[model samples]
Target: MKNRNYIHLFANCLITKGISRSVICDLQRSKYVLIPNSFADLFSKQRYYNLKEAPRIFDQENLSIFHEYVAVLKDHNFIFSCSKKELKRFPQLQLKFEYPAKITNAIIDFDKNSNTTIKDIIQYFLIPYNCRHIQIRCFEDMDSIFFDTLITEINHCFIKSVEFIIKDSFEQDYTQIMKWVENNRKIKSLVLHSSQENKVIQKENYGFGIVVTTRQKITSESHCGIIHPDYFNITIESYTESLCYNSCLNRKISIDKSGNIKNCPSMKQSFGNIKSIKTLDSIIENPDFNKYWTISKDKIETCMYCEFRYICIDCRAYLETPENIYSKPQKCGYDPFTNKWKWDYESFTK
Candidate 1:
C-alpha cells in the first residue's frame, strides 16, 4: 500500500485515553507532518517571497503544543485567544482578505434599557457598511412597538431583508405577527420562534408565517418547522469541522467576538482589536493573520482523514466545551465520533 501522505486528527476532552494514545502514535509515525502553530508561520514566510509549499500535516492538539511550536517558528502566526499584551509581542501578526458583502449581516439581541438605540445602531454600524440584512431579538415588552418601529426604519432605509426573533410567549397575538408579514411582502425571510404553548398559532395560519418551535414536544398536527436549539450538538470528525470552517471563511463573515476579531465567536484570542481598526480589511492585511486564514484542512490533523470534513461546521464553541460540543447536540440523535446519523437511521430503518 502507498504510504498515507495525509492524516487528520481531532481530539477533545472526551476521547478515551486509548484514542489519544493512538493519535499521538500516528503523529510520531508521519513522514513530514507540520504542527499547527508552526504551520501558520511557515505559510507566512513563504507568502512574502511569492512561494507556495504544501504543508503535510495539520495538528489540532491542545494549546500547549500550539504555543510551543509557535515560539520556535521564525514567522508570526495569528494568535487566537491571546490577550492584548501577548499580541503586542508579535506586532507583525496582521493579515487581510476580501470582504463578502452579500452575507455580511448582523444579529442584535436587544434588552430593555440597552444604551444603544436599535435603529441608530443599525443605521450607523450596519447600513453604512452596506450590510444586506439585520436580525433583531427583542423582549416581549418591546416586541409590538419595536417591531413596528423596526419595520418603518427598514423601509426608510430601503434595507433588503429583516428577521425578527420574538419570544414564544406572544403566541396568542398570532394575528399581529401575520399582519406584519403581510404588510412587508417584499421581505425575503420571516421566522418566528415560539414556545410549546404557542405552537398552535403557527399551525392555524400556515400561509403567511413560518413558526419555529423550541419545545421538544411533537404535536399531533404540525404545519411549521421545529428547531430545538439544544438539539444542535454532535461530535463531528475533524475534517468535517474544517469543511465548516472553510465554508464560513469563504463566506467572509467574522465569527470572532471576544476582545479581538478571530475566527469564531467562542474563541478567546484576538489578532487585533476590531473596534480600534474599524474594518476587517486592515486585520486581514497582517501577514501573521493572513497565515491563520490560509490554514487548510491538510494543515489540521483531525480534519485530514475524515470523510465528512467538507460538510460540517468546525465549531470553536465545541472546542470551548469539548464535552458538550463533542457529544451529539442534545436535540440531535447522531454520534459525532462514530460519524453516524442515528436520527436518520431511526427515522428510516423502522
Candidate 2:
C-alpha cells in the first residue's frame, strides 16, 4: 500500500470535536463514523500517510490493526490514494464568517388588539435575504380578511412557507381561508389552538398542512416544541458548517406583540423595535444581534457528548445555570456521561 505513494482525506469529509474521540462526517454522503483519538491525532497533522507508513510512524506492534483501520476508511470512500490536487477537484467544505442573517425564520406575535398590518410587518421585520419560514401567532380572533391580507402580503415577499396559529374562539371563514391558502403557495400550514376540547384533524396531505386542534389557552407557558432528527442530525449539518446546530437560531428572528425584534419570543434582549427600525437588514447586521448564532451544540456543556446533540432543539433563553451561556438546557434531564435521556414532556411545558 505504501507503493501507492500519497493519500489524502476526501475534501467533503469534516472532522468535529467528539467525546474522548472524534467524529468523521462525510457531508456529501451524509454518513458519519466515530474514530479513536489516535486516528484523530494523526489526521489532525494534515499529512496523510500510506498504510505501510502508518505502522512505522505510530510504532504499532500489530500492523494488522493499522491495516484494518485503513481498509475500513477506504471502504467508506473517506480516504483516497490520489494526490492532494485531485481532491481539490471536489468542492471544498467552507464555513462562512459573515452570514447575511442568522435568522432563517421569523415569528410574528399578535395580540387581541394588534393593529399592525401584514405589509408593515414584512417590510420592517422580515429580512428577505435570510428569512424563509414565517410563523404568525394570533392570540386574538382573526377573520378571513386578516388572513387574506396576510397571505397576499407574504406571497409578495421572499418568504417561502408560513404557519398560522390562532385561538379556537376566533371565527374564520374556512372556505375563504382554504381558497387563499390554495392560491398562495407560501401558506403552507395552519394550526388552531382551542382552550376547551382536544381534537385534531389530519390535513397534512392537503395543499396546506392544516391541523385544527384543541389545546389550552395561549400563555407565556403554552408552547409547542419539537426537534426534527432528520434535518437536525450531524450528517445534514456537516454540510452547513457556517450555521449553528440549533436550527431555530440558525438565521432566525422573532417579533413580539409589542413589535420588538428578538432572537426568540421568549428572549428579553430586544435587537430593535420593528415599528421604529427602517429595515431589518441593519438590525441583523449588528454583531450583538447574532451573538447566539455561533453557539453550536459541541460548544454547549452536556450537549457536547450527547448523541442527540444535533437533533435537540436548544433554548438559549433558559439554561441550567442561568449565568452560563454554555449551560445545559434547563428542561432537559439528559445525562450524556451515562448515555441516559430523562427528558419529560411535562417538564418541557414549563
Candidate 3:
C-alpha cells in the first residue's frame, strides 16, 4: 500500500463472477487465476485502488498484509504499478455474451445412389448467411464422378470445412479417396467405416486434412470429438443465461438420411424438408426450436458438482433418462457424488 503508486489490471485480463467465484483471465497470455476466498475482500477493493482508499479497505491492523499481497500481484504481472492517469485510461473488462445463430454447422445424410445432384443439396440446405460447415454421411462408396461433382459444388458454397463419413466394403479405394482430398482443400476430416472388424487403429495426415479408417459404424456421438482444456470449451455453455443453450444447439442444425431438417439428427422433431421453402432463417425464429439450446451443464443432474462440467460437451440426443431432457449424458459413466466412474467401480468389483 505504501510502496506502489497505483495498480492497473492488465489489458488482456478479465475478472468474472462475484468475489465468491472470481476468475482472472489473461487472454493474451492464456492464463487463468482463481483468487482464493480469503483475499476476496482485498481483491474487491483493489478494483479501484489508491493510497487513501487502501487504509479504509484494509485498516491499520491489515495494511501491512494488504501491501504484501499487492506486491505478489505485481510480481506475477496480474496488476502493474502505474500512474493515476494510466489507470484511468486502462480498458474495462466486461463479460461476453454468446448469441444464438440461424446456422453454424450441419450434418447431411447423402445417399450416393440417389438422383439428388450436388447443386440441389447445397441450394436446399446451405443458407449462406447462417451455415458455415457441414458433415456429409455417405452410406455407399462415392465414385470419382460423384466425388468430383460434390467437391466442386461445396467449394462454390465457400464453407469452412467438410467432414466425410463414408461406409466402404472390405477393400477401399485409397487412391481415389486421396485424390478427392488433394482436390478439395476444404475436406478437413475423412473417416472410412468398414462393416468387417478392423484389427489395427491408425490415422494419417494428408497435408492439412486428416484421414481416419475404422471398422466400427459411425454414430451421432462420433460426430463430437474429444474435449480438451482450452479457452473455447464446450462445457462453458453452463455460464450463458441466453436461451441459445449450447453452441452446438444454438442456431445449429442437421439434415438426416431422409432429408428431414432438425436441430440435430438424433432429435426426433423435424422442422421440414430441405426442398420446402421453410428456410432455416424462418424455422430458427420458432420458440420450440430454440428450446434445447439453453440446457446447460449446470442445470444437468449430477453435472453441477463435476469439475469437467465446464469442459465437456453436452448431449441432448442420448440422456440417462430418455424421457427427461435434463437428464445426465447416458455415455458419461462418471458419478460426481462418488467421484468415481461407474466403469472403474464395476472393474474394481470384478
lDDT of 3 by residue, 221-275 (tens): 3343222233234222333322135634655777777767787777788888766
TM-score of each: 0.45, 0.67, 0.65
Residue 302's lDDT in candidate 1: 48
Worst 10-residue stretch by lDDT in candidate 1? 13-22
The prediction achieving the highest TM-score against the true structure is 2
lDDT of 2 by residue, 1-350 (tens): 22455566787666654455556777677677767667766667563654556657765565666677677888999888865455445565555434454456788888756657768776655655556678999776767677777777888887778988877653434565455556676666766775455554546555565656567666542353433333444444433533355544757888888878888887778987766776777776788777777788778897777655554567677777978978876767657565444656455555
Model 1 TM-score is 0.45
> Candidate 1 overall Cα lDDT vs. reference?
0.40
Any runs in candidate 2 off by more than 4 Å, and if so which?
1-9, 26-42, 47-49, 52-91, 97-104, 127-132, 138-144, 165-182, 188-251, 271-290, 293-299, 304-313, 344-350
Ranking by TM-score: 2, 3, 1
Off-target runs (Cα >4 Å) in candidate 1 are: 1-103, 139-141, 186-191, 198-209, 216-245, 249-304, 320-337, 341-350
Error of 3 at 218 (Å): 2.1
